[model samples]
Target: MQEGVIVKALSGFYYVEDGQTIRMCRARGVFKKKGIIPLVGDKVTYTPIGTREGVIEEILARRVELVRPPIANVDQVLLVFSVKEPELNLWLLDRILVHTERARLPGVILFTKSDLLENGDECQLWVSAYEKLGYPVLMVSSRTGEGIEDVRSLVNGKISVVAGQSGVGKSSLLNQLSPELRLKSAEVSHKHGRGRHTTRHVELLRLASRTYVADSPGFSQLEFGDMEPEELAACFREIFELGQQCLYRGCLHETEEGCAVRPAAQEGRMAPWRYQNYLEFLSELKDMKERRF
Candidate 1:
C-alpha cells in the first residue's frame, strides 16, 4: 500500500495523488461497513491495482472538515467578496468569518473587481475595517491582474479553500492565478447584479508545486449548523471578548441591562451590523432550542 492524499472524489471514484502520479481508486469495503467515507483532502493508504488505478485501503485522520464543500484538512479559507456588481453582503461575510473562526481556520478576505471601484475611498474604507480586525485583506481584479501575486503568495504551500456568494468572481480569480484552470465564468445580470453559479462541485486544483485550491459552488444562504445560543458568541471573536466584560454573568448581550456588547456598539467600538447579526444568529438558536422541547 502507498500513502497519498485524495485530491478529488467524484462519482464514487477518488483520485489519490502519491506525489509522483494520480491513481484512480475506490474506497475499500471496510470504509462503507464502518461508515467512514473518504473525502477530498484526506490522506489515505491505497494499493495500486493497475496503471493510474488503485483501491483505498485506509483513511488517515483529518485536521479540519467542512460541510458545505465537504473538504477535509483545509489550512485556510479565502472569503471572496465583490466590491460592486453583487454588492458586498456584510452580514453574510460576518457569518462566514464566524464559521471559519469556529472551525479554527484562519480567514483571508479577498475583495474582487477592484477595477470596478471607481470611488477608491469606499474600497479603502472596506479594506481598512477588515484590516483593523487583523485579517489579511486583498483587492484583486482578474481583468486588471492586480493583487494576483499577493493572493498567489498566500495560497502557495498550503491547501486553501475559496468560498463566497455567487458572482464574486472566485473562479475568475482562480483562472487569473493559474490560467490552466480555464474554469467557467458567468457575467452578472444587469437587473439583479448577481452572477450565475458556474461551479457545480468542489474539487481541488494544483495551482503551483505545493499549493492546492479547492473551488466549490457559491453559497446563497449560509447556515452555521448546531451552534447553541450561548455558544454563538464564541464564533464572533470581537463580540465574544466584549461579552466577557459584561457586568451580568450570563448576559445574552441583547437588550440587557449593563450589556457590554451593546454599549460597545453604541460607542462605535464594535460594528453595529456585526452585533445585529449576532442577535439574528442567537434568535435562530433560541428558536431551535424551543422547537426541540
Candidate 2:
C-alpha cells in the first residue's frame, strides 16, 4: 500500500497526492462501514488501481479537525483580516483564535489591504497585541504584493488553513501567494461594507513540494459555544495565564470582584478588546449551559 495525502474530496472521490502524482480514489468499504469519512488533509494508505486511480484503505490519525470547511491534520490557521473594505472585526478575530486554540492548532494573524489604510494604526495595534500573546502576524496587500514573501514562508513545509470574514482579501491573498490558484474574488457591498462569499468549498492547494494551504469559506457568523465556560479562558493565551491570579479560585473574570483580568485590561496590560470578547464568549457559554440543563 502506498501512503498519500487527501488534497481534495468531491462527490464520492478523493484526490490523493503521493508526492509524484495525484490519484483519484474512492474510500474503501471498511472505512464507510465504520462511519469514518476521510477529509481533505488526512493522510491515508491506498493501493493504486490504475495509472491515476486508487482505493483509500486506511486513514491515519489526525492532529486537528475543523468543522466548517471540514479539514484535518492542519498545522496552523492563518487568520486573515483586512484593514479596509469590510473593516476588521475584533469579535470575529477573537472567535477564530478561540476555535484555533480549542483545536490545539497554532494561529498566525494576517492583515490584508494595508495599502488602503492611510495610517494603518488600527491594524498595527491588533498585530502588536496578538504578537504579544506569541502569535505571528503578517501584513500583506494582495494588490501591491506587500509581505507576500513572508506569508509564503509561513506556508512552506506545512499544512496551513486560511480563514476570515468575507471581503478581507483571503482569496486575493491566496492568489498572491500562489498565482496558480486564481480563485474567485468578490467586492464588498458599498452600502454595508461586507463581502460576499467567494470560496464555496474547502480544498487543499499544493503550493510547493511540501507546502499545502486549505482555503476555507469566509465566516460571517461563527459560534464559540463548542467549548465550556471554564475551558474558554484557555483559548486566550495571555488572559488564561493572568487569570490564575484572580482572588476567586474559579472566577469567570466578568463582573467578579478582584479579577486580575479586569485589572490587567484597566492597566493596559491586556488588550481590552480581547477581554471584552472573552466575556462575550463566557456569556454565550453560560446561556448554552442553561439551555442544555
Alpha-carbon TM-score of each model against the true structure: 0.94, 0.94
Candidate 2's displacement at residue 239, Å, is 1.4
**Considering summed lDDT, which 10 consecutive residues are worst modelled in model 2?**
218-227
Global lDDT of each candidate: 0.86, 0.87
List, residue by residue over 67-157, the lDDT tens digit for candidate 1.
Answer: 7778988999999999878998888888888888888899999999888887534678768777887799999999899999999999988
Record all residue pairs in model 2 with backbone atoms less than 3 Å apart, i.e. clashing.
none
Question: Model 1: how far is 132 from its true place, Å?
Answer: 1.9
Model 2 Cα lDDT, one tens digit per residue, 249-285: 8888887898889889889899999988888888899
**94: Cα error in model 2, Å:** 0.7
Candidate 1, residue 76: how far the Cα is off, in Å: 0.6
- Residue 230 lDDT in model 1? 82
